[model samples]
Target: MTVPSSGLRSPEARRFLNDRLDWNLLRTFLVIGQEGSLSRAAARLHLSQPAISQALKRLEEQLQVSLVIRRGPRISLSSAGQEVLQIAAELYGTVSRLGPALEEPAETVTGRVHLLSISRIQSRCYDDFLARFHQDYPQVELEVDVLRSSDVISALLQKTASFGLSLCRTPQPRLEQRLVLQQRYAFFCGRRHRLFGRKHLNLADLQSENFVSFTSDQLGGNLSPLTVFRDQQGFTGRIVASSASLDEILRLVDCGFGIGCLPEHIVAADVQAGKMWRLPPGDGVSDVNVYLLWNREQKHTQAEALFLERFEHMLLTTELGERF
Candidate 1:
Protein backbone atom coordinates (compact mmCIF):
# COMPACT_ATOMS: atom_id res chain seq x y z
CA MET A 1 0.00 0.00 0.00
CA THR A 2 1.06 3.60 -0.63
CA VAL A 3 0.64 6.69 1.64
CA PRO A 4 0.89 10.41 0.90
CA SER A 5 2.29 12.77 3.54
CA SER A 6 1.27 16.27 4.63
CA GLY A 7 4.10 15.97 7.22
CA LEU A 8 2.37 18.11 9.91
CA ARG A 9 2.35 14.92 11.94
CA SER A 10 3.60 11.43 11.13
CA PRO A 11 1.03 9.06 9.71
CA GLU A 12 -0.80 7.29 12.51
CA ALA A 13 0.52 3.78 13.27
CA ARG A 14 -2.93 2.32 12.57
CA ARG A 15 -2.69 1.21 8.92
CA PHE A 16 -6.48 1.40 8.68
CA LEU A 17 -7.20 4.78 10.25
CA ASN A 18 -10.47 5.09 8.36
CA ASP A 19 -11.35 1.43 8.75
CA ARG A 20 -10.45 1.38 12.46
CA LEU A 21 -12.79 4.17 13.55
CA ASP A 22 -16.27 2.70 13.89
CA TRP A 23 -19.15 5.18 13.67
CA ASN A 24 -20.96 3.11 16.29
CA LEU A 25 -18.24 3.74 18.88
CA LEU A 26 -18.15 7.52 18.43
CA ARG A 27 -21.93 7.49 18.69
CA THR A 28 -21.56 5.50 21.92
CA PHE A 29 -19.22 8.15 23.32
CA LEU A 30 -21.77 10.90 22.63
CA VAL A 31 -24.53 8.94 24.35
CA ILE A 32 -22.25 8.33 27.35
CA GLY A 33 -21.43 12.03 27.40
CA GLN A 34 -25.12 12.77 27.70
CA GLU A 35 -26.15 9.85 29.95
CA GLY A 36 -22.85 9.95 31.94
CA SER A 37 -22.67 6.26 32.85
CA LEU A 38 -21.62 2.99 31.31
CA SER A 39 -24.81 1.17 32.36
CA ARG A 40 -26.98 3.80 30.74
CA ALA A 41 -24.79 3.89 27.65
CA ALA A 42 -25.01 0.11 27.53
CA ALA A 43 -28.79 0.17 27.76
CA ARG A 44 -29.00 2.82 25.07
CA LEU A 45 -26.65 0.97 22.77
CA HIS A 46 -28.54 -2.27 23.51
CA LEU A 47 -25.25 -4.00 24.19
CA SER A 48 -23.74 -5.83 27.18
CA GLN A 49 -21.12 -4.33 29.49
CA PRO A 50 -18.37 -6.27 27.76
CA ALA A 51 -19.49 -5.16 24.33
CA ILE A 52 -19.71 -1.49 25.32
CA SER A 53 -16.33 -1.70 27.09
CA GLN A 54 -14.76 -3.27 24.03
CA ALA A 55 -16.16 -0.56 21.79
CA LEU A 56 -14.80 2.06 24.15
CA LYS A 57 -11.47 0.28 24.20
CA ARG A 58 -11.32 0.12 20.43
CA LEU A 59 -12.03 3.85 20.24
CA GLU A 60 -9.33 4.67 22.80
CA GLU A 61 -6.86 2.40 21.07
CA GLN A 62 -7.51 4.13 17.75
CA LEU A 63 -7.03 7.58 19.25
CA GLN A 64 -4.05 6.58 21.44
CA VAL A 65 -5.61 8.20 24.52
CA SER A 66 -7.70 7.25 27.53
CA LEU A 67 -11.04 9.06 27.30
CA VAL A 68 -12.81 8.20 30.54
CA ILE A 69 -11.67 8.70 34.12
CA ARG A 70 -12.60 6.12 36.75
CA ARG A 71 -14.23 7.67 39.82
CA GLY A 72 -16.43 5.08 41.45
CA PRO A 73 -19.40 3.96 39.27
CA ARG A 74 -19.75 7.41 37.66
CA ILE A 75 -17.24 8.08 34.90
CA SER A 76 -15.96 11.47 33.68
CA LEU A 77 -13.90 12.16 30.58
CA SER A 78 -10.20 12.98 30.89
CA SER A 79 -8.83 16.05 29.08
CA ALA A 80 -8.03 13.95 26.02
CA GLY A 81 -11.45 12.32 26.27
CA GLN A 82 -13.06 15.75 26.54
CA GLU A 83 -11.30 16.80 23.35
CA VAL A 84 -12.45 13.59 21.65
CA LEU A 85 -16.02 14.05 22.79
CA GLN A 86 -16.08 17.63 21.52
CA ILE A 87 -14.51 16.70 18.20
CA ALA A 88 -16.74 13.67 17.83
CA ALA A 89 -19.80 15.82 18.41
CA GLU A 90 -18.60 18.35 15.85
CA LEU A 91 -17.71 15.64 13.37
CA TYR A 92 -21.05 13.87 13.74
CA GLY A 93 -22.83 17.18 13.41
CA THR A 94 -21.01 18.10 10.21
CA VAL A 95 -21.87 14.79 8.57
CA SER A 96 -25.56 15.47 9.17
CA ARG A 97 -25.68 18.75 7.21
CA LEU A 98 -24.34 17.88 3.73
CA GLY A 99 -25.63 19.54 0.48
CA PRO A 100 -25.34 22.71 -1.65
CA ALA A 101 -26.41 25.04 1.14
CA LEU A 102 -24.47 23.11 3.79
CA GLU A 103 -21.29 22.36 1.76
CA GLU A 104 -18.69 22.52 4.57
CA PRO A 105 -18.22 18.84 5.54
CA ALA A 106 -14.75 17.61 6.66
CA GLU A 107 -16.14 17.05 10.15
CA THR A 108 -17.84 13.65 10.34
CA VAL A 109 -18.65 13.26 6.66
CA THR A 110 -22.29 12.38 7.28
CA GLY A 111 -24.68 12.47 4.35
CA ARG A 112 -27.54 14.89 3.58
CA VAL A 113 -30.51 16.58 5.21
CA HIS A 114 -32.64 18.64 2.86
CA LEU A 115 -34.83 21.67 3.70
CA LEU A 116 -37.33 23.97 2.00
CA SER A 117 -38.43 27.52 2.78
CA ILE A 118 -40.14 30.53 1.28
CA SER A 119 -38.01 32.98 -0.67
CA ARG A 120 -38.88 35.92 1.56
CA ILE A 121 -37.75 34.16 4.71
CA GLN A 122 -34.79 32.44 3.06
CA SER A 123 -33.30 35.80 2.09
CA ARG A 124 -33.04 37.00 5.70
CA CYS A 125 -29.30 36.83 6.46
CA TYR A 126 -29.02 33.16 7.42
CA ASP A 127 -25.91 32.48 5.31
CA ASP A 128 -23.58 33.85 7.99
CA PHE A 129 -25.47 32.08 10.74
CA LEU A 130 -25.46 28.75 8.87
CA ALA A 131 -21.76 29.15 8.10
CA ARG A 132 -21.06 29.32 11.81
CA PHE A 133 -23.15 26.17 12.32
CA HIS A 134 -21.00 24.54 9.62
CA GLN A 135 -17.79 25.33 11.50
CA ASP A 136 -18.69 23.01 14.37
CA TYR A 137 -20.37 20.18 12.41
CA PRO A 138 -19.07 20.23 8.88
CA GLN A 139 -20.15 16.74 7.81
CA VAL A 140 -23.85 17.36 7.61
CA GLU A 141 -25.07 18.32 4.16
CA LEU A 142 -27.88 20.88 3.80
CA GLU A 143 -30.02 21.69 0.79
CA VAL A 144 -32.23 24.77 1.00
CA ASP A 145 -34.99 24.99 -1.59
CA VAL A 146 -37.10 28.11 -2.17
CA LEU A 147 -40.79 27.75 -2.82
CA ARG A 148 -44.00 29.53 -1.95
CA SER A 149 -45.15 28.81 1.61
CA SER A 150 -48.12 26.89 0.24
CA ASP A 151 -45.84 24.92 -2.01
CA VAL A 152 -43.58 24.26 0.92
CA ILE A 153 -46.39 22.68 2.91
CA SER A 154 -47.52 20.68 -0.05
CA ALA A 155 -43.99 19.45 -0.49
CA LEU A 156 -43.79 18.41 3.15
CA LEU A 157 -47.04 16.48 2.90
CA GLN A 158 -45.78 14.75 -0.23
CA LYS A 159 -42.51 13.80 1.48
CA THR A 160 -40.50 16.08 -0.76
CA ALA A 161 -39.02 18.14 2.07
CA SER A 162 -37.40 17.01 5.30
CA PHE A 163 -38.28 20.42 6.79
CA GLY A 164 -39.98 23.70 5.99
CA LEU A 165 -39.53 27.37 7.01
CA SER A 166 -42.14 30.04 6.30
CA LEU A 167 -44.34 32.85 7.58
CA CYS A 168 -46.92 32.17 10.30
CA ARG A 169 -50.29 32.50 8.67
CA THR A 170 -53.70 31.31 9.90
CA PRO A 171 -52.70 28.13 11.74
CA GLN A 172 -53.92 24.66 10.90
CA PRO A 173 -53.87 21.30 12.73
CA ARG A 174 -52.47 19.13 9.96
CA LEU A 175 -48.88 20.27 10.51
CA GLU A 176 -46.95 21.54 13.52
CA GLN A 177 -46.45 25.31 13.53
CA ARG A 178 -43.55 26.50 15.63
CA LEU A 179 -43.12 30.24 16.11
CA VAL A 180 -39.39 29.96 15.57
CA LEU A 181 -38.78 33.44 14.17
CA GLN A 182 -40.58 36.78 13.97
CA GLN A 183 -40.93 38.81 10.78
CA ARG A 184 -42.20 42.38 10.38
CA TYR A 185 -42.75 43.99 7.03
CA ALA A 186 -42.07 47.64 6.40
CA PHE A 187 -43.42 50.00 3.74
CA PHE A 188 -40.68 51.06 1.33
CA CYS A 189 -40.05 53.25 -1.71
CA GLY A 190 -37.10 54.16 -3.87
CA ARG A 191 -34.81 56.95 -2.64
CA ARG A 192 -35.98 58.90 -5.67
CA HIS A 193 -39.67 58.11 -5.14
CA ARG A 194 -42.14 60.88 -4.32
CA LEU A 195 -42.67 59.65 -0.76
CA PHE A 196 -39.00 59.31 0.19
CA GLY A 197 -39.22 61.00 3.60
CA ARG A 198 -42.93 61.25 4.17
CA LYS A 199 -44.25 61.03 7.72
CA HIS A 200 -47.69 60.01 8.98
CA LEU A 201 -48.71 58.47 5.67
CA ASN A 202 -51.99 56.65 6.18
CA LEU A 203 -53.06 53.34 4.67
CA ALA A 204 -55.56 55.25 2.57
CA ASP A 205 -52.66 57.19 1.06
CA LEU A 206 -51.42 53.98 -0.57
CA GLN A 207 -54.73 53.24 -2.33
CA SER A 208 -53.59 55.04 -5.44
CA GLU A 209 -49.98 53.86 -5.16
CA ASN A 210 -48.47 51.37 -7.56
CA PHE A 211 -48.08 47.98 -5.86
CA VAL A 212 -45.55 45.31 -6.71
CA SER A 213 -45.99 41.92 -5.11
CA PHE A 214 -45.05 38.29 -5.10
CA THR A 215 -46.78 36.28 -7.82
CA SER A 216 -50.23 35.24 -6.62
CA ASP A 217 -49.58 31.53 -7.19
CA GLN A 218 -48.14 31.10 -3.70
CA LEU A 219 -50.48 30.01 -0.92
CA GLY A 220 -51.25 32.32 2.03
CA GLY A 221 -49.36 34.63 -0.22
CA ASN A 222 -49.17 36.69 -3.41
CA LEU A 223 -50.06 39.97 -1.71
CA SER A 224 -48.70 40.35 1.79
CA PRO A 225 -51.34 40.21 4.52
CA LEU A 226 -50.13 43.71 5.40
CA THR A 227 -51.52 45.01 2.10
CA VAL A 228 -54.99 43.56 2.64
CA PHE A 229 -56.60 46.95 3.18
CA ARG A 230 -55.87 47.95 -0.40
CA ASP A 231 -57.52 44.87 -1.88
CA GLN A 232 -60.40 44.78 0.63
CA GLN A 233 -61.44 48.38 0.16
CA GLY A 234 -62.32 47.89 -3.53
CA PHE A 235 -59.14 49.64 -4.63
CA THR A 236 -56.26 48.15 -6.61
CA GLY A 237 -53.01 50.00 -7.29
CA ARG A 238 -51.33 50.29 -10.70
CA ILE A 239 -50.41 46.57 -10.24
CA VAL A 240 -47.65 46.92 -12.80
CA ALA A 241 -45.83 43.70 -11.78
CA SER A 242 -45.33 40.77 -9.41
CA SER A 243 -42.38 38.49 -8.91
CA ALA A 244 -41.15 35.56 -6.86
CA SER A 245 -37.58 36.78 -6.98
CA LEU A 246 -36.48 38.97 -4.05
CA ASP A 247 -33.53 40.44 -5.90
CA GLU A 248 -35.78 41.68 -8.67
CA ILE A 249 -38.24 43.03 -6.16
CA LEU A 250 -35.50 45.03 -4.46
CA ARG A 251 -34.34 46.32 -7.81
CA LEU A 252 -37.85 47.46 -8.72
CA VAL A 253 -38.26 49.18 -5.37
CA ASP A 254 -34.89 50.87 -5.75
CA CYS A 255 -35.79 52.15 -9.20
CA GLY A 256 -39.12 53.69 -8.06
CA PHE A 257 -41.27 51.04 -9.77
CA GLY A 258 -43.80 51.07 -6.95
CA ILE A 259 -44.38 50.99 -3.20
CA GLY A 260 -42.84 47.81 -1.83
CA CYS A 261 -43.19 45.63 1.25
CA LEU A 262 -40.18 43.96 2.87
CA PRO A 263 -39.61 41.83 5.91
CA GLU A 264 -38.02 43.69 8.86
CA HIS A 265 -34.80 41.62 8.74
CA ILE A 266 -34.31 42.31 5.05
CA VAL A 267 -34.91 46.05 5.15
CA ALA A 268 -33.55 47.08 8.55
CA ALA A 269 -30.66 48.92 6.99
CA ASP A 270 -32.84 50.87 4.58
CA VAL A 271 -35.35 51.71 7.28
CA GLN A 272 -32.57 52.86 9.62
CA ALA A 273 -31.27 55.23 6.96
CA GLY A 274 -34.73 56.76 6.49
CA LYS A 275 -35.61 55.24 3.16
CA MET A 276 -38.63 53.22 4.34
CA TRP A 277 -41.43 54.10 6.80
CA ARG A 278 -44.20 52.32 8.60
CA LEU A 279 -47.79 53.20 7.80
CA PRO A 280 -49.04 55.55 10.57
CA PRO A 281 -50.65 53.92 13.57
CA GLY A 282 -54.44 53.08 13.53
CA ASP A 283 -54.21 52.24 9.86
CA GLY A 284 -54.38 48.54 10.67
CA VAL A 285 -50.75 47.75 9.79
CA SER A 286 -49.57 44.60 11.60
CA ASP A 287 -46.73 42.08 11.80
CA VAL A 288 -46.42 38.32 11.36
CA ASN A 289 -44.32 35.42 12.66
CA VAL A 290 -41.69 33.50 10.75
CA TYR A 291 -42.55 29.88 11.41
CA LEU A 292 -40.83 26.52 11.00
CA LEU A 293 -42.76 23.39 10.04
CA TRP A 294 -41.76 19.81 9.46
CA ASN A 295 -43.20 16.34 9.24
CA ARG A 296 -43.64 14.50 12.56
CA GLU A 297 -40.69 12.37 11.44
CA GLN A 298 -38.51 15.46 11.27
CA LYS A 299 -39.01 15.91 15.00
CA HIS A 300 -37.05 12.72 15.61
CA THR A 301 -33.67 14.00 14.45
CA GLN A 302 -31.21 15.40 17.01
CA ALA A 303 -29.65 17.68 14.38
CA GLU A 304 -32.97 19.30 13.61
CA ALA A 305 -33.70 19.85 17.28
CA LEU A 306 -30.33 21.51 17.85
CA PHE A 307 -31.00 23.82 14.90
CA LEU A 308 -34.35 24.85 16.32
CA GLU A 309 -32.79 25.49 19.73
CA ARG A 310 -30.05 27.69 18.31
CA PHE A 311 -32.51 29.47 16.03
CA GLU A 312 -34.94 30.26 18.81
CA HIS A 313 -32.10 31.39 21.08
CA MET A 314 -30.75 33.83 18.51
CA LEU A 315 -34.21 35.32 18.01
CA LEU A 316 -34.74 35.69 21.75
CA THR A 317 -31.37 37.39 22.18
CA THR A 318 -32.18 39.81 19.40
CA GLU A 319 -35.52 40.64 21.09
CA LEU A 320 -37.30 40.45 17.76
CA GLY A 321 -40.77 40.71 19.26
CA GLU A 322 -39.95 44.02 20.97
CA ARG A 323 -38.63 45.38 17.69
CA PHE A 324 -42.07 45.03 16.19
Candidate 2:
Protein backbone atom coordinates (compact mmCIF):
# COMPACT_ATOMS: atom_id res chain seq x y z
CA MET A 1 0.00 0.00 0.00
CA THR A 2 1.34 3.43 -0.95
CA VAL A 3 1.38 5.66 2.13
CA PRO A 4 1.46 9.46 2.54
CA SER A 5 4.73 10.86 3.93
CA SER A 6 2.85 13.35 6.23
CA GLY A 7 -0.79 13.31 7.55
CA LEU A 8 -3.29 10.48 7.12
CA ARG A 9 -4.81 11.84 3.91
CA SER A 10 -4.07 9.29 1.19
CA PRO A 11 -6.57 6.42 1.00
CA GLU A 12 -3.99 3.81 2.06
CA ALA A 13 -2.70 6.05 4.87
CA ARG A 14 -6.24 6.76 6.07
CA ARG A 15 -7.14 3.09 6.06
CA PHE A 16 -3.90 2.21 7.85
CA LEU A 17 -4.52 4.80 10.59
CA ASN A 18 -8.18 3.86 10.91
CA ASP A 19 -7.29 0.20 11.34
CA ARG A 20 -4.61 0.81 14.01
CA LEU A 21 -5.35 4.13 15.71
CA ASP A 22 -6.70 4.22 19.28
CA TRP A 23 -8.78 7.17 20.54
CA ASN A 24 -6.95 7.05 23.90
CA LEU A 25 -3.69 7.74 22.02
CA LEU A 26 -5.11 10.90 20.47
CA ARG A 27 -6.50 11.91 23.87
CA THR A 28 -3.10 11.42 25.49
CA PHE A 29 -1.43 13.53 22.79
CA LEU A 30 -3.87 16.32 23.53
CA VAL A 31 -3.04 16.21 27.24
CA ILE A 32 0.68 16.13 26.45
CA GLY A 33 0.31 19.16 24.19
CA GLN A 34 -1.73 20.99 26.81
CA GLU A 35 0.62 20.38 29.71
CA GLY A 36 3.89 20.70 27.74
CA SER A 37 5.36 17.77 29.72
CA LEU A 38 4.72 14.06 29.56
CA SER A 39 4.95 13.67 33.37
CA ARG A 40 2.46 16.54 33.93
CA ALA A 41 0.08 15.08 31.35
CA ALA A 42 0.44 11.68 33.04
CA ALA A 43 -0.52 13.27 36.35
CA ARG A 44 -3.53 15.01 34.78
CA LEU A 45 -4.71 11.80 33.12
CA HIS A 46 -3.99 9.66 36.21
CA LEU A 47 -1.74 7.41 34.11
CA SER A 48 1.94 6.55 34.62
CA GLN A 49 4.50 8.68 32.75
CA PRO A 50 5.68 5.68 30.72
CA ALA A 51 2.10 4.86 29.70
CA ILE A 52 1.53 8.39 28.46
CA SER A 53 4.79 8.24 26.51
CA GLN A 54 3.82 4.89 24.96
CA ALA A 55 0.34 6.21 24.00
CA LEU A 56 1.86 9.24 22.24
CA LYS A 57 4.35 6.97 20.49
CA ARG A 58 1.58 4.67 19.24
CA LEU A 59 -0.43 7.65 17.90
CA GLU A 60 2.61 9.05 16.07
CA GLU A 61 3.48 5.64 14.61
CA GLN A 62 -0.12 5.09 13.38
CA LEU A 63 -0.24 8.50 11.69
CA GLN A 64 3.34 7.91 10.36
CA VAL A 65 4.19 11.38 11.66
CA SER A 66 5.92 12.66 14.77
CA LEU A 67 3.36 14.65 16.82
CA VAL A 68 5.58 15.90 19.69
CA ILE A 69 9.12 17.34 19.94
CA ARG A 70 10.52 16.22 23.28
CA ARG A 71 13.30 18.23 24.93
CA GLY A 72 15.22 17.27 28.13
CA PRO A 73 12.51 18.50 30.57
CA ARG A 74 9.69 19.90 28.43
CA ILE A 75 7.70 18.94 25.30
CA SER A 76 6.62 21.01 22.31
CA LEU A 77 4.33 20.28 19.35
CA SER A 78 5.86 19.61 15.93
CA SER A 79 4.31 21.29 12.87
CA ALA A 80 2.30 18.11 12.25
CA GLY A 81 1.33 17.98 15.91
CA GLN A 82 0.12 21.58 15.70
CA GLU A 83 -2.22 20.71 12.85
CA VAL A 84 -3.33 17.55 14.60
CA LEU A 85 -3.81 19.49 17.84
CA GLN A 86 -6.31 21.80 16.17
CA ILE A 87 -8.17 18.82 14.79
CA ALA A 88 -8.04 17.13 18.15
CA ALA A 89 -9.42 20.29 19.76
CA GLU A 90 -12.40 20.25 17.42
CA LEU A 91 -13.03 16.58 18.12
CA TYR A 92 -12.62 17.10 21.85
CA GLY A 93 -15.04 19.97 21.78
CA THR A 94 -17.64 17.62 20.35
CA VAL A 95 -16.81 14.77 22.69
CA SER A 96 -16.97 17.02 25.76
CA ARG A 97 -20.54 18.04 25.00
CA LEU A 98 -21.87 14.49 25.10
CA GLY A 99 -22.54 14.60 28.84
CA PRO A 100 -24.14 18.03 29.14
CA ALA A 101 -26.04 17.42 25.92
CA LEU A 102 -27.49 14.26 27.35
CA GLU A 103 -28.26 16.06 30.59
CA GLU A 104 -30.18 18.76 28.76
CA PRO A 105 -31.88 16.76 26.03
CA ALA A 106 -35.06 18.63 26.85
CA GLU A 107 -33.75 21.69 25.04
CA THR A 108 -33.57 19.80 21.77
CA VAL A 109 -36.75 17.78 22.17
CA THR A 110 -38.67 18.49 18.97
CA GLY A 111 -41.90 16.57 19.10
CA ARG A 112 -45.41 16.68 20.52
CA VAL A 113 -46.45 15.91 24.11
CA HIS A 114 -50.03 14.78 23.93
CA LEU A 115 -51.83 15.13 27.27
CA LEU A 116 -55.31 13.89 28.16
CA SER A 117 -57.10 15.85 30.88
CA ILE A 118 -60.46 16.35 32.43
CA SER A 119 -62.36 19.52 31.66
CA ARG A 120 -62.14 22.74 33.70
CA ILE A 121 -58.74 22.38 35.26
CA GLN A 122 -58.44 25.59 37.25
CA SER A 123 -55.00 25.49 38.83
CA ARG A 124 -52.76 28.52 38.49
CA CYS A 125 -49.70 26.49 39.42
CA TYR A 126 -50.34 24.03 36.61
CA ASP A 127 -50.89 26.80 34.05
CA ASP A 128 -47.76 28.60 35.14
CA PHE A 129 -45.69 25.42 34.96
CA LEU A 130 -46.91 24.72 31.41
CA ALA A 131 -46.09 28.29 30.33
CA ARG A 132 -42.58 28.01 31.69
CA PHE A 133 -42.11 24.53 30.25
CA HIS A 134 -43.10 25.88 26.86
CA GLN A 135 -40.67 28.77 27.14
CA ASP A 136 -37.84 26.42 28.04
CA TYR A 137 -38.63 23.92 25.31
CA PRO A 138 -39.91 25.99 22.41
CA GLN A 139 -39.41 23.16 19.94
CA VAL A 140 -41.85 20.89 21.75
CA GLU A 141 -45.44 20.93 20.60
CA LEU A 142 -48.06 20.58 23.33
CA GLU A 143 -51.50 19.15 22.63
CA VAL A 144 -54.07 18.85 25.40
CA ASP A 145 -57.29 16.87 24.81
CA VAL A 146 -60.15 17.22 27.24
CA LEU A 147 -61.92 14.05 28.26
CA ARG A 148 -63.69 12.52 31.22
CA SER A 149 -61.43 11.33 34.02
CA SER A 150 -62.15 7.70 33.20
CA ASP A 151 -61.52 8.36 29.53
CA VAL A 152 -58.26 10.05 30.39
CA ILE A 153 -57.19 6.98 32.33
CA SER A 154 -58.29 4.77 29.48
CA ALA A 155 -56.26 6.72 26.94
CA LEU A 156 -53.21 6.56 29.14
CA LEU A 157 -53.64 2.83 29.60
CA GLN A 158 -54.03 2.40 25.86
CA LYS A 159 -50.75 4.30 25.36
CA THR A 160 -52.52 6.86 23.16
CA ALA A 161 -51.87 9.64 25.67
CA SER A 162 -48.42 10.77 26.65
CA PHE A 163 -49.69 11.80 30.04
CA GLY A 164 -52.92 12.31 31.91
CA LEU A 165 -54.52 14.74 34.32
CA SER A 166 -57.68 13.34 35.83
CA LEU A 167 -59.79 13.05 38.94
CA CYS A 168 -58.81 9.67 40.40
CA ARG A 169 -60.48 7.85 43.24
CA THR A 170 -58.32 4.74 42.96
CA PRO A 171 -55.05 4.17 41.21
CA GLN A 172 -55.54 2.01 38.14
CA PRO A 173 -53.31 -1.00 37.57
CA ARG A 174 -50.38 -0.49 35.18
CA LEU A 175 -50.53 3.27 35.70
CA GLU A 176 -48.32 5.47 37.84
CA GLN A 177 -50.41 8.04 39.64
CA ARG A 178 -49.33 11.21 41.43
CA LEU A 179 -51.69 13.59 43.17
CA VAL A 180 -51.29 16.95 41.50
CA LEU A 181 -54.04 18.97 43.14
CA GLN A 182 -57.08 18.71 45.40
CA GLN A 183 -59.81 21.09 44.27
CA ARG A 184 -62.74 21.78 46.54
CA TYR A 185 -66.06 21.39 44.81
CA ALA A 186 -68.87 23.68 45.98
CA PHE A 187 -72.54 24.10 45.14
CA PHE A 188 -73.36 27.05 42.95
CA CYS A 189 -76.51 28.54 41.42
CA GLY A 190 -77.02 30.78 38.42
CA ARG A 191 -78.62 34.23 38.45
CA ARG A 192 -81.99 32.77 37.45
CA HIS A 193 -82.03 30.12 40.17
CA ARG A 194 -84.04 30.60 43.38
CA LEU A 195 -80.98 30.01 45.58
CA PHE A 196 -78.93 32.62 43.73
CA GLY A 197 -77.77 35.34 46.11
CA ARG A 198 -79.54 33.64 49.02
CA LYS A 199 -77.27 33.94 52.04
CA HIS A 200 -77.07 32.13 55.42
CA LEU A 201 -78.22 28.82 53.90
CA ASN A 202 -77.61 25.36 55.35
CA LEU A 203 -77.37 21.84 53.88
CA ALA A 204 -81.10 21.44 54.53
CA ASP A 205 -81.89 24.40 52.29
CA LEU A 206 -80.29 22.56 49.32
CA GLN A 207 -81.94 19.19 50.11
CA SER A 208 -85.11 19.91 48.17
CA GLU A 209 -83.40 21.93 45.40
CA ASN A 210 -82.84 20.19 42.09
CA PHE A 211 -79.19 19.60 41.17
CA VAL A 212 -77.01 19.18 38.14
CA SER A 213 -73.59 17.57 38.16
CA PHE A 214 -70.90 15.69 36.28
CA THR A 215 -71.71 12.37 34.68
CA SER A 216 -69.13 10.79 36.98
CA ASP A 217 -70.80 12.20 40.11
CA GLN A 218 -72.08 8.88 41.33
CA LEU A 219 -70.85 5.84 43.24
CA GLY A 220 -68.20 3.69 41.45
CA GLY A 221 -67.25 6.61 39.21
CA ASN A 222 -64.16 8.82 39.11
CA LEU A 223 -65.91 11.59 41.08
CA SER A 224 -67.19 9.24 43.74
CA PRO A 225 -66.04 11.63 46.44
CA LEU A 226 -68.70 14.06 45.32
CA THR A 227 -71.27 11.28 45.41
CA VAL A 228 -70.19 10.22 48.89
CA PHE A 229 -70.39 13.84 50.03
CA ARG A 230 -73.93 14.29 48.72
CA ASP A 231 -75.01 11.04 50.33
CA GLN A 232 -73.54 12.14 53.64
CA GLN A 233 -75.25 15.54 53.40
CA GLY A 234 -78.64 13.82 52.94
CA PHE A 235 -79.17 15.59 49.63
CA THR A 236 -82.28 13.91 48.12
CA GLY A 237 -82.66 16.39 45.27
CA ARG A 238 -82.89 14.80 41.82
CA ILE A 239 -80.12 15.41 39.29
CA VAL A 240 -81.96 17.54 36.74
CA ALA A 241 -79.18 17.51 34.14
CA SER A 242 -75.76 15.92 33.71
CA SER A 243 -72.81 16.18 31.38
CA ALA A 244 -69.22 15.07 31.18
CA SER A 245 -68.02 18.56 30.28
CA LEU A 246 -67.83 21.20 32.97
CA ASP A 247 -68.59 24.01 30.51
CA GLU A 248 -71.87 22.40 29.55
CA ILE A 249 -72.80 21.82 33.18
CA LEU A 250 -72.06 25.45 33.91
CA ARG A 251 -74.24 26.48 30.97
CA LEU A 252 -77.05 24.21 32.14
CA VAL A 253 -76.91 25.74 35.61
CA ASP A 254 -76.76 29.22 34.15
CA CYS A 255 -79.87 28.53 32.07
CA GLY A 256 -81.74 27.70 35.31
CA PHE A 257 -81.71 23.98 34.68
CA GLY A 258 -80.79 23.36 38.35
CA ILE A 259 -78.02 23.99 40.83
CA GLY A 260 -74.57 22.63 39.96
CA CYS A 261 -71.41 21.71 41.80
CA LEU A 262 -68.06 22.92 40.49
CA PRO A 263 -64.59 23.85 41.49
CA GLU A 264 -64.83 27.22 43.23
CA HIS A 265 -61.57 28.67 41.97
CA ILE A 266 -62.54 27.94 38.35
CA VAL A 267 -65.70 30.05 38.53
CA ALA A 268 -64.48 32.78 40.86
CA ALA A 269 -64.65 35.37 38.12
CA ASP A 270 -68.16 34.27 37.19
CA VAL A 271 -69.27 34.41 40.80
CA GLN A 272 -67.74 37.85 41.18
CA ALA A 273 -69.63 38.98 38.08
CA GLY A 274 -72.92 37.60 39.49
CA LYS A 275 -73.03 34.97 36.74
CA MET A 276 -72.98 32.32 39.47
CA TRP A 277 -73.50 32.24 43.21
CA ARG A 278 -71.59 30.04 45.67
CA LEU A 279 -73.96 28.26 48.01
CA PRO A 280 -73.78 27.64 51.76
CA PRO A 281 -71.78 25.08 53.83
CA GLY A 282 -68.62 26.60 52.49
CA ASP A 283 -66.25 24.64 54.76
CA GLY A 284 -67.48 21.06 54.55
CA VAL A 285 -67.60 20.71 50.76
CA SER A 286 -66.03 17.74 49.05
CA ASP A 287 -62.52 17.99 47.59
CA VAL A 288 -61.65 15.91 44.54
CA ASN A 289 -58.05 14.85 43.92
CA VAL A 290 -56.69 15.43 40.47
CA TYR A 291 -53.87 13.07 39.62
CA LEU A 292 -51.04 12.94 37.12
CA LEU A 293 -51.11 9.54 35.48
CA TRP A 294 -48.79 7.78 33.09
CA ASN A 295 -48.54 4.21 31.85
CA ARG A 296 -45.35 2.64 33.15
CA GLU A 297 -45.22 0.03 30.42
CA GLN A 298 -45.56 2.51 27.58
CA LYS A 299 -42.48 3.81 25.86
CA HIS A 300 -42.46 7.62 25.85
CA THR A 301 -41.02 9.98 23.29
CA GLN A 302 -38.32 12.43 24.26
CA ALA A 303 -40.71 15.34 24.52
CA GLU A 304 -43.23 13.31 26.46
CA ALA A 305 -40.62 11.98 28.89
CA LEU A 306 -39.07 15.39 29.44
CA PHE A 307 -42.39 17.11 30.04
CA LEU A 308 -43.59 14.38 32.36
CA GLU A 309 -40.36 14.32 34.35
CA ARG A 310 -40.28 18.09 34.78
CA PHE A 311 -43.94 18.26 35.69
CA GLU A 312 -43.45 15.48 38.20
CA HIS A 313 -40.50 17.34 39.66
CA MET A 314 -42.61 20.47 39.95
CA LEU A 315 -45.31 18.49 41.68
CA LEU A 316 -42.81 17.08 44.14
CA THR A 317 -41.31 20.46 44.95
CA THR A 318 -44.50 22.52 45.13
CA GLU A 319 -47.01 22.29 47.94
CA LEU A 320 -50.51 21.03 47.27
CA GLY A 321 -52.12 24.20 48.54
CA GLU A 322 -49.98 26.30 46.23
CA ARG A 323 -50.68 23.94 43.35
CA PHE A 324 -54.38 24.02 44.11
- Best by the TM-score measure: 2
How well is each residue in 250-314 modelled by candidate 2, as lDDT tens digits? 99999999988888888889999989998877773788888889998999887887787678556
Taking the tens digit of each residue's C-alpha lDDT, what string does model 1 give over 72-100? 88999877777667777676666554532
RMSD of 1: 15.3
- What would you estimate as the lDDT of candidate 1? 0.63
lDDT agreement with native, every candidate: 0.63, 0.81
Compute the lDDT for candidate 2. 0.81
Query: Candidate 2: misplaced stretches above 4 Å?
Result: 1-107
TM-score computed on alpha carbons, candidate 2: 0.66
